[model samples]
Target chain A: MLKVEVDRTQCQNFGQCVVEAPNVFRLNSRDEMEYTPDVEDAELDNVEAAVDVCPMQAISLALGR
Target chain B: MSPPVVIVGASLGGLRSAEALRRCGYAGPITVFGDEPHAPYNRPPLSKDVLGGEVTHAAVAFPQRAATSDVEWRLGTRIRSADLEQRSIRTTDGEEVRYRALVVATGLRPKRLSPRTATLAGAFALRTLDDAAALRNALHPGVQVVIAGSGFVGCEVAATARQLGCEVTVVGSAELPMLGPLGSALAEDVMRRHVERGVRFRMGTHVAEALGQEAVEGVRLADGSEVACQVLVEAIGSLHNTEWLDGNDVNAAQGLRTDSAMRVLRADGSSWRDVFAVGDVARFPNAIYGDEPASIEHWNIPTETAKRASRILALQLAEDPRLDAAIAERFAPVPSFWSDQYDMSLLAYGLPALADRVELLAGKAGGDCVYGYFVGDRMVGVCGIGMRSEVLKHRDEVSRYGHVPIGEPAR
Candidate 1:
């Protein structure tokens, strides 16, 4: 398992992550970012894409959740 | 020791390319060369935050990942030319580097107002961090700033200058500012918003001459009118940094023409397997827009193209079984761009400018609204100001558009 973290302080809710990896990240009705903290190892590619597109550079992924 | 993969231009594209190479399982040596003195830094903020506030390299520098730590970085080294047939590149200082693979990530330089190439002290063009830093000092309260061009940079800088209490007057060639990208309606709204914020515009004209003795004092518009300015900012456009590729047989007339796989193509339409391009430099075909190749200089393009190019390069380097099959799945990256001017947060998916007509999709015309861009019957793009959620819903439609079955010709 890989652990995903988003620094809300830096996040502007650009929703780029939601476009890249919709399964793990989403924008709520208020347009606030809601994301899955833990992701399966198989979701690395998608999660990594999400990290790259985050203009704020807020998303982070690590091994061994 | 074998020759390493050499990537030119050390900005967002170069950094992303190096990182993607590692991600795609290429363990070999990678070297990136850049003309700028500083390491890779984000550029989007240069016109907004950095321009409005204190400008520094640290504030906008992209975070370096551990995976690409071993990648050699040669900053402030200008490559004079490259011989693709010889598989070698010569630096301006007479240094030669034989690269196993070359990634042409050299992006663009801002185009200045012609007829006057002199380096006036107060005159600036906001492309590099240095440009922003220099322009920052002249942007204090009550300074009369004349910005040439009405593109994103021009408008953004106008807004930022207004925020800093500078008197900004934007001179544009088009009837309305940002007419090429944003349609008339949204542009009117944007212009209205800017006007509300006290930013003036001189539409349907261009800066013919920068009038000054030493530092820029004013500009003479092509309309035969003169506006006194304390600072002059030329945000006209950009020229591709492809001059170093002079002797090469590559089609760099526009940007380097590339196949959908990111391989640099020759004038005869043959692609060089080892030479690829990414970011604003690579004019690759987008599936949503059919087979027409274009160089989209959006913020997301660097990371997107770098990842695709790295995947293919890594596979080729490793001699993977997947290499035999021509990339059947065409590179289908959904184009995206965003901008901030005053209180408006502009978000867009796909090339909205490519559309012939734009229709109201959701929300009111004057306020937060979504507009769907259409070509014929298919909705090609979606753009809106403020309605983030509503606008994003059509992202899939834009991605799936133009299924007209147009791609690389049979070759």
Candidate 2:
């Protein structure tokens, strides 16, 4: 399992993350950010791509204990 | 035998291109040349954390995200001349290298101030890690700093200087800072934020001259007014680093002109099949901008263009038939850029240069808000401060209907 965290204060919501990992992160009707805190190990690469494309350097990922 | 793939300018674009080649299963010899001795690093923080003494050059160096450990790197070397006819480049160290495919990512250099002002001891320009490190050390509490130009670099430096407890004043030739790309509404918001933080602005005036003979004592404005300062930082503009390609048919005056697929265009309006250009140095036509040849300085353009160039280069080298259709596709990516100043972060999507009108879609104009920039009826660009989610929603809309009609209700 993996845990993901996003610093809301630092995030500008450019949606580059959404384009990379749509299953993990998304935008709601009001265009606000929504994401899953935990994900399967198979989704690691997708989540990592999201973390890399973040413009504000807000996303972080770590393996769960 | 096909020659090795050669990449010039080992910055973000060059580094990414190397990685993309490997990802496409290109196991051939790959060589990267960079004039800078250091590895590719994130430049956005040079004006932010680097100037504020929050981080060192090593801290900002780009992480090894791609599989480029095998790529041969020639650091601290410059290509003096290039022979497009022979498909070879001469280096400063009296070495010539041949290439089957060439990728030019030379990027840009900061436009220098006047000869008089540029030669001043205390005056500086921020473009590389060394520049940021020196400026950070020079800036201290109570030091007076005057910045010329109100672009992203200039505004960001002012914010960092202010955070360092320095007396900062910014001079710009426009009525409002960044009024051209950000529009007047959002530009006003940015100006208000700076004023509230005690940073002074000298709008609609240029820096006529740099004061003092030995060092920069102050700067003289076009209005015959002088602002006393100990240091002067010039952030006027940047020119493409295309001097080495002088004898070539490239549009060196503007930038290296390229076709839609990022192929270099010769003087006769034809593109070189084996040569490609990326990053700030590539002036290529974009479908989103109505096929106009535009060079984007944003951080995202380099990454996107590099990916496209690598796929094309790999296909040619490997003679892969599986991805032949992919090569015919045009190079189009949703251009985006961000600027951090004080506590406010401004994020924009699409090319705002084509917009003729700017409208406040959400929030107050002078406050944290979102503004939609339109070219007549179509929305060409969107930018907002502290309105991250609101601006992200319009990303697809801006790409699909570049001329999306803005309703009167939003206005």
Candidate 3:
């Protein structure tokens, strides 16, 4: 499993991450971001892409035991 | 043994290049030089949160994703001169550093008004972290602030000043603020938003002179009208920081022109194989835009260009025979930039300057909307005001690499 974290304080809800990894991240109706805290390990690459494209660099990922 | 790869500027571009070099499996020593005494920090917030006093001084720091322990950091050291033939740069402290590969990311310096006006006590410009801190300190309630130029920096500063309860009066040479970049309709919308926020505008005019003999008491317009101000910020524009390349064949007056691969081009139009220019300092001919040479000053350009430069450097460091051929290859990443003012977050993809026609794609023009700029039948740029998802869809459609080019002619 992959554990994801987003620093909401730094996030401006640019939604670049959602476009890169839609399965892991999504924006609410208010245009704010909401993402899955944990996801399948196979989705690591997609999550990593999100990390790179996040405008605010607010996304962080950790691998689960 | 190969000489270490040396990166100048030590900001976003420099740091990202170092990290990308490591990711590319380059085992060589890496060194970064910065004129500023502090570590690399995020610059986009300098005019927003940093100037708004909404975030702490440390809040604006860019995440140091690049490991610093292995990299040699020469902070507060400015480069004075460069010798392209010798492949070395001399620092202001009289130190010469030779490198196997050089990455120039010196970026830009804010353009100030005349020395006479800029030297005034209350006159300022926000570029560096120190500049933002100083400007934030002056944003007391009811402080009359006069900002020259209606560019992103000036408008952002005005919005921030209003948030801090300061009275702001923006003076610009355009009839509507941000008309050059945001288009007249959206610019008028932004201007109206500012007016609704109680910020004043003196449009279609230029600042004739800085009022007050000691401090900036106000600004005298070309029409002989004076706007009272306790503080003055000249957010006019920026000049590329290329003075260190003074004697080099590259054009320092404009920007250091680079070939498709971001290699610095000499006056003879030959590529400097081991030397590359990244970030705002690099003026490269973009392949997507039909090889039009432009210097993009957006925040993301540095990161994207740095990655490309690192990939090329890595391939070269590995003694790959393809390095020579790769040097001539084109790197055309879809350019993007964003600006935040009050509640509006303007996002743009592709180059708006390349468009001849613009159409409203989704939503209303003044409200949350996406505007698409086209060159004939092809979408060249897409911009939005508070429209995130709609802009993303356009971004995907406009990008050459993103889900089939929207209007590519059959080859």
Clashes of each: 0, 2, 0
Better of 2 and 3 by DockQ: 3
Clashing pairs in 2: B378-B403, B378-B404
Q: Answer with 1 or 2, whichever has the higher lDDT.
A: 1
Specify the highest-lDDT model's number.
Answer: 1
Candidate 1 lDDT: 0.87
User: Compared with the true structure, what per-residue lDDT tens digits does model 2 show for residues A1-65?
Assistant: 99999989766566778877989998776667789999998888788667756765578888888
For candidate 3, lDDT tens digit of each residue in B283-320? 87666765645787777778778888888889988988
Model 3, B84: alpha-carbon shift in Å? 1.6
Recovered fraction of real interface contacts per model: 0.43, 0.43, 0.36
DockQ numbers for every candidate?
0.68, 0.43, 0.51
Residue B376, candidate 1: how far off, in angstroms? 1.8
User: Which residue pairs in model 1 clash with each other?
Assistant: none
Cα distance off (Å), candidate 3, residue B11: 1.2
Root mean square deviation (Cα) for candidate 3: 4.0
Let me know the DockQ for model 1: 0.68
Ten residues in sequence with the least summed lDDT for candidate 3 chain B: B402-411
lDDT of each candidate versus the true structure: 0.87, 0.82, 0.82
State every prediction's TM-score relative to the real structure: 0.96, 0.91, 0.92
Candidate order by TM-score, highest to lowest? 1, 3, 2
Task: Give iRMSD, candidate 1.
Answer: 1.0
